[model samples]
Target: MSARSGPRRPAGLGATTRAGLKPAIFVTLVSVLAVVVAAIASAPFRSSTNVESLLFQMAPLLLVAAGQATVILIAGIDLSVGSMMSLATVLAASGSAFGNSAVAVVAVVLLVGAIGGLANGLGVLSGVNPLVMTLATMAVFRGVALLVLGQPGGSVPSGLLTPLTNVYGHVPLPFVVALVAIVLLWFATAETRWGRSLYATGADERHAASAGLPVRRTILTAYLVAGLFAALGGLALVARIYSGDPLVGDPFALDSITAALIGGIAVTGGRGSVLAVVPAVLLLSLTDNLLNLFGVFSYWQYVAKGVILIVTLWGYHAAGSPSGLLAMARSGWRARDARAARGTKA
Candidate 1:
């Protein structure tokens, strides 16, 4: 008697994956259109320097979004990701305090992230709401980050950061890292058994458990993965700035969630595609780059992001759900059938 043989197994999981891909595909097409339009309309936006800048900007956000999406897939959220990122940067920059060994700092940062994630998971298992538990950890992690660095003043070895900036024909190392993260995560969520289990657990926890899935472990793993990715994002940020800032990651918590949602991840969980996040990140990074090229005030970029987020959310919901493209298609078919029936009667 395997979990797959359980009465809970149905056609929904396969449909869910396909449904999620619809929004991802839509976002990808839109992202491509945006790139083309921006390049055609603005010379600077298409320049080599700006292209590099956009890629650099997209790298860290993509990493963080990957982690955020993992948590979201399991019907959970990790608000502390931003704080975890902030903590990672400070820890990495504090290598001087830890015998100036980069490896030790990196190891410590990852460890802290794992511990933080595990704590969140354990709290959730103890009946704490995921939102409440992560919110509390968010404050705690930020506090620890501040206490460690107090401000943006620690340095990373230039030697280590240089390779991250190396560009081969305009493809920076950071962007390559982001691409790798995307591929690996896409594989995990799409091909692995654990990945399928994640969707199951998220879709219906009680049924997933009855089907013999390790519901508790799945939840824990999701948070742990998120923490590690946030840490990786923080490391990427360090490569960008060559220093640590306790406040730098403050925007990431919301931004990652925005990207995930915009990319087609349902807020309710178990109903989105990780692959969709790439275009969502690209669109966001492009919007910022284009805004700068057009000389828009920095504050207005926030307004623009908010507007885009609202429009996408409204559009997705109106269609049906986060996984609404499939639903929209089905509705279209039914409507066509109705129209044909009416015509025949006439």
Candidate 2:
């Protein structure tokens, strides 16, 4: 009411931003706590060697998850990314055919990824469901990778692998690449007009289209970006393993999605922050690392990841979407009251 009071900020936008940010804050705290506990419990976890390895393990997932998060933001998913990564590794290992040059391999892989993404986008536009379209591509890409190299014997030039895995002091180069990508993507999703369009379109495609937000273009571009990121993940994988395995990327499709969900990216699409993906990825990588260090069976690792994902989903269902939770609770209460009335009559 003061005469000198400045124009009030938009309350709705402020509330939305805060709502979107809450999960990220919770996840960040959880990640930090997990790190601290792990370090205290296992001296080896605090070692520089293990720290470097953890970063190395996280890089590929970080790349793939960022892209996954992008597509997810637009209410679309790219199941083919793991296969795309597989294809990239095989191509990179097909020495001499690509002039034995790392650059050539990278270029071709990126092109393939973009083309694959374009195909997915076009398919979705043409009435194909995103899940089915990407799933089909997943099979195709993996088959192509196998055709390129039936076995995992092809050699990647040390030139490509060496620099990718190199550490500057305690930081792995691949982690740096992942971190830069996360930062850039965070900026784009949080700051840019395109990012706003992405959130709008994902929140409601029909409404976004009516608002003239270029919904189609945003969807197509999102898929293309996902493809490019998956290719980058493939390249990172090459550095980690120093060899191409047709099945090397098999786990990534699920892993990337899991990371995105765990990072607070809404399953329904339009909510959440990309910045949270960093800690989400770290949490996953750290869990796996600690499990291995503690001599847990590989099968148990899968069980642990599944449990974590389920818990995250439940938390979001219960806390993130208040309306849905309230509706469910109200329905349940009405049903209970009806049953009580029937019992009284009896």
Candidate 3:
């Protein structure tokens, strides 16, 4: 035998391949689950009308979650995303009410968001912990939003509203926008060299830098991209509510984080897919729908929602358990099978 096999495979190669496959499989299982849940919820839940409405409502969350996933991919988080969106709402409203026009409002939100993200990246590069830096920015943005709109009321330009909430060829504009985001993000993360660099950096920053990657630039790019998405999410929120509310984005930070996690984006970073988020968003939406249909008390909704997240994630986080998602999915599918069994007996 040769002293060394022709070329010993790099140990990380198997791991890298596994890392890529894990998210895809996890997403596939979760998607299958969301469908079954819809079927059980009600007949209308599976209808085209409901699909359109669901897509409309989910559009903004998709935007926000898409960004949140990217941030987490690089072992970073942006707590201020919700505040960035809140700022968008107020800015959009004030601009419309003040006659600043649709294009002006969009421009301001996207621009400011990018600036804020730039600041976050700079802060982290200067050696501040990313969490602390982003948390501080979150406070600043929320304070600014409150200063702009102390109350839960303001106008969204009629011109902006028409296209966002309106339909085109049986598809709402928001749905189309969300689709574009997914496609763009998918291409960026899956096809580009910078995207590969991001995964490499997240997997091991030291190693990535040593491999000739521009680690700092990649991190900054992720933040900037996240900011753009947050701005877009804010625009979607404006369409949905048609007004500005200081607290409009309060739920986004948590919801987007949860959605990203459920979608197979790891909290530790370096592994996930925006494509997975499609099904995860639907699953969360379906859960909310079922809660409403079952007449769950308003106050209890939080408890129920928390329970769902916990149970689902508990199996997911179980260490070395051969994929927590597979376990949760198996249980979920078995439940579906049981439901079918009862139907057969009936």
* Most accurate candidate by lDDT: 1
Looking at model 3, residue 231 earns an lDDT score of 82
Model 2 lDDT-worst window of ten: 1-10
Compose the digit string of candidate 1's lDDT tens values, residues 1-346.
Answer: 1223222223445555676777576668878999999989999887898888888888889999988998888878889999999998898888877777667777888899889888988888899999999999999999999999999978775555667668878778878988898879877876677787887777556656766888899899888889988988898888778888998998999999999888888665666888788999998988788888899999999999988787776666665563323333444534533533343344
The positional error of residue 261 in candidate 3, measured at the CA in angstroms, is: 0.7
Name the candidate that leads on TM-score.
Answer: 1
Model 3 quality (TM-score): 0.81
* lDDT per residue (tens digit) for residues 249-344 in model 3: 878988888777776675655566666677677777766766665667777766755665665556455533222244345445345335334433
**Residue 19: error of model 1 in Å?**
2.4
Go through the candidates in order and give the clash count of each.
0, 0, 0
Give me the displacement of residue 132 in model 1, in angstroms. Answer: 1.1
Among residues 3 or more apart in sequence or in different chains, the pairs in candidate 2 whose N, CA or C atoms overlap within 3 Å are none
Whole-model Cα lDDT of every candidate shown, in order? 0.79, 0.78, 0.72
What residue pairs are clashing in model 3? none
lDDT tens readout by residue for model 2, 1-346? 1101111112333344466567666667878998999999998999998998898889999999999988887778889999999988888888568877878877888898899888888888788999999999999999999999999969887677778778999898888988898889877876676787777666657655766778898889889988888988998888788888898999999999999888777655666677777888988887799899899998888888877776665665667442212324543534533533343344
Clashes of 2: 0
